[model samples]
Target: MATINVRRDVKDSFYRYKMPRLLSKVEGKGNGIKTVVPNMTEIARALSRPPSYPTKYFGCELGAQVKCDDKNERYIVNGEHDAERLQTILDGFISKFVLCASCRNPETDIIIKNDDILMDCKACGAQNMADMRHKLSTYIVKNPPAQASKNQRKQRKAATAQTNELGGGFENEEGGSDDDIISQRINKEAAGLSMESKLAQEDWSEDTSEAAVAQRMRELSVKGVAAFAEDDDEGGESKYELFGAWLDEQDNNTISDDDIIAKAEELDVYGKYKACQVLVQCIFDESIAAQIPKRANLLRKFVTEEKHQKAALGGLERLVGLEYKDALMKKVPGILMKLYDVEIIEDDVFIKWGEKPSKKYVAKDVSKAVKKAAQPFLEWIENASEEEDSD
Candidate 1:
């Protein structure tokens, strides 16, 4: 069995055109017991989203069981007979038909078989298949079914395999055909590139100059970066465009370095939440934290993102914990007081480092710099506790 990700555009086409046609065929030809095909739209939708998201692909029991589509008809279980046609159907899907990302092939005859972890590949008769996994993940990434490479298409159309000068003969390596070897190599290269893309693009070399950052900061400060709250649309992207105009004001050296920080300050206030996020993110490239606000205006957005927010807080704590420990501790109470009064959804969101709470502790320690903005948050947590426990 194989799984492939269809490009979003290809997916849209299938939903808008191909799938409807397939559905029509099914509807028109139904006699008594309808042999219904799985809804490609439902499959595509499930596969397109993130894993933890609601209504996403939990897993597929498809291709694992050899069963008939007709629920009414008493169909005989015929895994072997269906395998070839199912493979052909899935091949058609990878060609133009939209397919699910989780083991898409209809020919797949895998079974749970009492919680067995190992998937013994019925097609190649291989166990513990790393190569097969690579093939599946690679197919899922490519999405919109691509034209078979020119060389591959030629090989497929070829009647017989003949030896080439470079030892890529028709008979190729042990057991597999030349086409199979080519496909494997192509898959390997594609997988490597895919991995490279997924990695966060951070350039944290100590030697890199902060010139670009300073210049951009100057632009943002002057033009004023936009900062729209997530809940507040203000007709979308109002924050980023203002900052972009500021960036456009400078070409190479149109702005002077002496006033760059000043310019960045001006841009900081009006930037969009999304743009502001990027501006703060730019510190990874430009370590000149002095170019931006001493106060973390950017920290407001940290509450929304689960992973990045944790990274942001932990990194800041590690940084400030060592450098300005005495000053941070002095200001901690005030900050927590302020934070407690603010609209934080979770009380523990303001928790700081160096303090260990009980294993089942809920709210953060109240007297911290982070909580100075809202001290009432602690009281709110206590009040909410009763409601939560009752539920």
Candidate 2:
């Protein structure tokens, strides 16, 4: 009944994430030899993934047949296998499907969108598309988890109910029904020889005097200003414009960090972590290694959660992956170490980024090279983690 961290890469004994150790029993004999996982359901529940996913993954890895009996809750892999070997294979499934690509958290749910499978992290709110190159992805796409289907149905029902509530009611008239009022208004509008009236009205134009024109222009100006003010009150200044202007002012040393924070609040960009995105975009140009400490204060102020951290990292990735690929390919470890030293990014975040080279944020070749450059740091962290585990 011993439990271990869901992510074996994490060596913290007090790590919040855990699952029961893999248990297996060899069954049958000779030609009919197989392995049975008695507690697969319990392990799957702890990992927040379907039992079939791991069961099928084992088969794919071992080049054997597998059977998943949902009705009986029995998962069997053909050919005799030991618990230790199966557990190693299970780690592959955990990394590919259960763990969040951004935060490396196990609180993830699989979703199907447009026939593509995606892993959505409840912890970080990152939607990462599953690598379709894997055989298990095809299985997941064709046979999605039942919980996702139920949630989709629930969402559809809630949306339909909201639509009904918004469009259901009719305004009550004081004297008559809405239909009667509409009918009367239409009749009055159409009354009294419309063709003759139209001909007469064509010849009778309104005043075109300079005074009249000036008065009309004044009225329009007043209304336009009032409408603009109302819109400003509701939506505030455009966030992009405000952030851009603040960045320009900062380059000229006309504004302090306090000034920018206050302006972000006024622009309604502080609470949602939009300021962190802007700060990343503006503070670091082609090189972020030396600027990590300089912008650490801003990152700490705004990047409070995994989502915000991921967004800031995303901006950095764009800066390096697009414009400074050579620099990233050379100094990835130094840049990552600087970010880690400043506590701007977490170990898991960097580890996950280094483990998988994502084309979503950078070119495939660039992502690969960047990740390759980060191997030394990644290996150091892994060794450090093992040392921690030993202690």
Candidate 3:
């Protein structure tokens, strides 16, 4: 994960929302979150850009520019300092001189003077740039980009495999994107169009062709999804305005049946595993299966999946059978037990080195992921509670 760099708009945007995400990976997930308070001098250097220096200055003097010195200047981004905010800001970056691996604390007494890096840690005193460089470089080298992911791993493997690979992106087949068009043309001819498209061929537009079809139901009403989904199971019709609002059906809150089938066929674009939860949840009626593709058709035709298997089954849990229920339920118990009803845990938390323990009960962020994953089950339990009350 690349660290988030300086971006002013940190309001409701991703910077604020995903900060905890980044924080969790480094501190929350990795080795129980080693919180290194960034050395203050490095923090200041990072938040405020380093003063630009001349080109030749790079060999001997450029080092001085980034290092804390009379010339290096303490961080006063837009002219103020709140060390915590500065910390959150730096969470967005991958590489910069501001990062120090030996010491993670931002408030470290180590500040670079004109000729050297001086440490406040009792064991290490002042050290020259060459020494700091050697130490920091070793750590950086060992760190393996600090944010390796599956994509990065694959790219790394591919890079090593081929000598002709350029700039470390993926190797590709020659025909470019047009190959997709040719393949699709053959697929369309090979697989005949169903009644829905044959009937509504004139109404369909070319604009949303590239739009991901699986997510269409999330935008539509359940009733609409079902009506469009069921071929033989039809009565009421839907005024489906492709990218439109939830249909206004006067009789019921549940969406119309037509939209369900339309949305179900849309499921064909993605793999079954990826589409199942969303497709299951968005389905309003089962009768529309006659018109929809395979899984949606299966759902439309069968509704007796009645083993109370709806536990974490998205919205359409009532219709999906025991096999799905058994598989899904097994995974939920441990996650629920791990995160649910747990107010606090006694793992080490980062407070200022000498700043005394904060009330341990107050830091709720440590358990956020477990709580987030637990949300649907929590809602299910609440709904069950309501039903029990009504009973």
Candidate 4:
């Protein structure tokens, strides 16, 4: 029933992507002993890959024969194997097949072209060719999935619909001349425009009051700010300023997480980590431990990269380690566990962070003390990894 980060390398307990833990049951004995992955289909669904891919990957890695019965939803690898060993091999499959080389997100679709395998990332829109040196590429090329046929059918249907809509303009039941039909269409459009012009002239009005003028100016100013904020080329300045002004206008009351996420989307701040930096400062108080879980959705929406993840974690470090040091010291591990559960920080990121004092988040001494406080959780993760390796 336990779940782990989809990207096994990511140790964050709070990571948004997760998969059911690898489960294996050893069957038979002696030369006939084999490992059956009871939840191969479920894990493959979580990774957005076919169950056979990982099963074959295990076979290739372990030098054993494998059987993948798609109809019966059973995956078996020859020879005795433990869950921990198979789980480790699964990570290799994930790195080669699922994760995008360019953006590192696991949202990728495999493409086979010119006898080569390509990975197309849906998140960052990058195309990367799978290394042909891997044995799995040959299998994938030979046994391609059915997604391509479905996509082609959808495309053909869409093209037919578009052609029909455009073809409607030139239909001639009575076999009229092309020139005559064109002229008739032009005349009809001209008449409609003329009617619209007359209606516009009749509806014209002007408000000359000073109040109306002031209101119009305010509306225009707001519109200009919104336009600037939504312009992606303008960087985060406009978004930060606009969000700052909104926060300032809220008086002393806290803003709702939904409102914050909505505003971030409206301002086109989704991909920019700087917006996350600004959000952390404005949204949380001294007691960030209690607020982290509540605001996890917003964090997940914005923090997709290592930089953004580190930035958000750094913000939390400053909030808890500096402002509420005395109150949160004893609760540091629990707070970190919550962050991990929500996937705010990965294992490597958190472990590397706790290993040394970095001025990136706070003063040298404060960071050192914070990392020291997090030692217990770090040790627990290390111990777990050791146990898995021993198994």
Model 2 is weakest, by summed lDDT over 10 consecutive residues, at: 168-177
TM-score of each: 0.24, 0.38, 0.20, 0.43
lDDT of 4 by residue, 1-391 (tens): 4789877765545344579889876654456567778679889888867899899999999999999977656688999999999999998898889888875667678888999988987655789998789898899999876574566546544533332333424423321222433444555677799999999889468687999999898667656665665444455376666675665566324667668767766665655666666666566665666877777756655665567666776766776677778887777788888878765565666766677788965898887887788889889866755565566
Residue 290 deviation, candidate 3, in Å?
A: 31
**lDDT per model vs. reference:** 0.33, 0.69, 0.30, 0.71
Better of 1 and 3 by lDDT: 1
lDDT of 1 by residue, 1-391 (tens): 1233232223322121121121100111112112222233333333322111111111111232223322221111222223334334433433222222233211112222223222333223343312223323333344322233567436423412221223443542222234544544565677798878876475656443598778777556444423332332344444444444544455423444324334444544322234433333233212223322332322432232333333443433322343455544344344434433432123344433223332211224322343342334445555554455555
RMSD of each: 20.7, 22.4, 21.9, 16.0
Arrange candidates by lDDT, descending.
4, 2, 1, 3
The model with the greatest TM-score is 4
In candidate 2, stretches whose alpha carbon ends up further than 4 angstroms from where it belongs are 148-391
- lDDT tens string, model 2, 255-336? 4566766756655566354456566766676557776776665565566556666666666666666767765657877877
Tell me the deviation in Å of residue 367 in model 2: 70
Error at 86, model 1, angstroms: 25
Clashes of each: 44, 0, 41, 9
Badly placed stretches (over 4 Å) of model 1 are: 1-178, 184-308, 314-367
Q: How well does candidate 2 score on lDDT at residue 364? A: 77
Sort by TM-score, top down from the best? 4, 2, 1, 3
